[model samples]
Target: MQVEMQDIHKAFGKNQVLTGVHFELLPGEIHALMGENGAGKSTLMNILTGLHQADRGTILINGKERSFSSPKEAEQNGMAFIHQELNVWPGMTVLENLFLGRELKNGFGFLKMKEMKALAKEQFERLDVDIPLEQEAGLCSVGQQQMIEIAKALMVNAEVIIMDEPTAALTDREIAKLFEVIDTLRKQGVSIVYISHRMEEIFTICDRITVMRDGQTVDTTKIADTTFDEVVKKMVGRELKDRFPARAASLGEVALEVRNFTRKGAFENISFSVRAGEIVGVSGLMGAGRTEIMRAIFGLDRMDSGELYRNGKKIKVHSPGEAVKHGIGLITEDRKDEGLILDFSIRHNIALPNVEGLSSKGFIDGKEEQQFVEDLIKRLTIKTESAETSAGNLSGGNQQKVVLAKWIGTNPDVLILDEPTRGVDVGAKREIYALMNELTDRGVAIVMVSSELPEVLGMSDRVIVIHEGKLSGELSREEATQEKIMTLATGGE
Candidate 1:
């Protein structure tokens, strides 16, 4: 099967998101879509998957023109899209999520639970996914949830599979398993559209690549014919000198210390210290308690026992407000759900954390708020028309930036970033790395939680690994290789 989009054009009111975008995917081949933050990749995928209709263009499935009225229609036509965000119901079981709307039933009109469970188990075994069939989806790890999503697509017998940042939260071992599954799908003649920001994964799996810039198609070429630098340049239209900035040598006194941090069923005995000018990375599997530790530190979750010290002085943090007042900031993992006020404009979102700073005598200073937001947008290189633009309308990467800008406005001494670059593009990722370095250089301590090992190794001055709600190991940047991190993260240490 071959899927092609010809001259696709889509717009929302006066804003054009996709302009004359063209792409093609051949059977047994992985086609990658590369672009900057707001380059219309998601819009185009939405159009293809029938979530949005193209204003003008033609979609040909197996060289036959077709129009889909809804995502169900697209799915019926052998197309499936695995969104960047998982859509499975947390309360449902794996079998239930796999056959959600299309459940198999007997003539008695009852759900065939046994059959569904057996089928789901077989599918997982075939895909080498170790998700439990009867377990609640919410109890599963992020990587396991993703595998369930893929299994659901396979259950539908989709010929054209569109994966949007499928590996964003997956560990190296899980990613390798996913690649193996993709290979098997390709061998069975499935046409795949792989969207991702990680260049290494693209080069490893994709056969051809299409670069989109500002809603327009820049170029399409074979993966073997282009270099990573070339693809990145085409995506952002600029040369990025370095992905991670140089770390400063001078270190101030310990800014934050957590001793005997214990959270029942989450993490225990976690002891770590962050210096004023250091960036420490916590790397682990999806359920390895990395995010849980950060959440506890920021007072988002209750801790059974922990002693926290700031500059050698013990302090108690009981809430997010207290954490913020104590010069602590947290960038949550789920930006859409926890980080942003989507109804507000960029200026409003950026001013949210530091609203008091922008207010005077019970009235907000609009001019001061605008100036601060403008400066932040400039500093972060957020590609937006103006500060008045709605935060919801911004791209995923820009939205993440807005979250960062909002936190930075609070002027925190310690910043905690959880999956900071989860859905950002290559260019935006470079900017974020540079910003992290700049913040650390200015005497701010950073504690980063990420599933990406390369990012942890590249950006952190020191790395800590957590496994099954316990601190497993710690290493300096030089000692934190992919193998060592994996070993420690999986409790091999």
Candidate 2:
């Protein structure tokens, strides 16, 4: 099937999301839609998938004019949309979720459980996946759930599928498997609209690329004819330079220390220390105890036994309140769920950590709160509408900045960040690195855990590797290499 969207325009109140953007997908080709956060990639795809109607646009399918009223209509017409956030129900089994909308029914109007399972199993087999069909989707890993979503698309014989950031949470092995599946689909004459911020994946899987900037189409080019530098320049409309900022010049005394941190099967004897003005990058594979360690320090998760020290004095953190009171802040991996309350305004999120300072005897000083939020928002370059906009309403990058603002407002001595730039764009990533440099320059200790090797190598002053819930090795910035990090992460001597 051939899809064409011409002269698309969309707006939400005063925000002009898309401005006369044009996009197309040819049959059996992988077309990459590349852009930064708030560059209108999601809005353009939303319009194509029938989730939102473009204020002014025209869509044609195989030379026939069509406007879908719902996602079902689009699916029925051979179009499928895969969102960045997986849409599987944690409580439902894989078989149940696969046939959720279009379930097989028996003559008695009851669900045909056997038929559904058989079909789901067949689809899994077709995709070369060995998933537990009866297992609850929530129990499955993120990569397995993603494969199930692809199988859902296959069940409907979707010819044109829009996959948004499909590999954001996947490990290296899972990503390779996903690429294999994408290759199979391509051979089946299935057209794919792949969206992502990762440069290497775009060049690897996409045959053609289209760049969008500030709600308009910048240029479309083939992978063979264009270079990475050119594509990045087109995306940001800025000069090409390094993605990671310069590291801090010097380090201070140890600010945070953890000794013999034990959590049974989760992690054991985990120990590390961070000096002021230093960035420590924790590198590991999935389930390597990196996030578990951070959570324990921040009081989100408890350790069976451990010793935590702040400024050389031993302390205990039984809850998150205590962590914050001790001048410790955590920017969680999933910003939408763990970091911010989506329904609250930017001001509220920034003020949440400092409520005690802004309140007196349970009474909040509105003037003080406003003044504080305004200054922080300006300092952080958070792109929001007057600090009154809801955090949920902001783009991915700006939302991350808001998360940073909230943490920085707490005036923390030690900060913990987990996968800070997981789904953010290039421009936002550079900004975030610059922010880290700014923070460390002021002698704030930082512990960062990232799965991206480039990020770990580029920003970390020291790199620590974990394997199977144990500390593998540590390397200084001058000594660390991606090969060495991987070796340690996989239990090398």
lDDT of 2: 0.88
Q: At residue 60, what lDDT does model 2 achieve?
A: 92
Best by lDDT: 1
Query: Over the stretch 275-378, how does candidate 2's per-residue lDDT look in tens digits?
Result: 99999999988768888899999999989999999999999998899999998999987786678898999999999989999998899999999999999899
All candidates' TM-scores? 0.95, 0.95
Encode model 1's per-residue lDDT on 1-493: one tens digit a residue. Answer: 7888999999888788888999988988999998998999989988888899999999997899987889999999899999887887989987788998999899999999888888888888877888777789988867788889988988888898999999987867778888998998999999899999999999999999999999999999999999988998899899877776676646799999999999988898999999998999998888888888998999999999989998889999999999998899999988876899888999889998888988999899988988999999999998888898899888889999999999988989999999999999988898899899889889999999987777898899999899999989999977889999889988897
lDDT of each: 0.90, 0.88
Candidate 2: stretches off by over 4 Å: 122-131, 134-136, 139-148
Model 1 collision count = 0
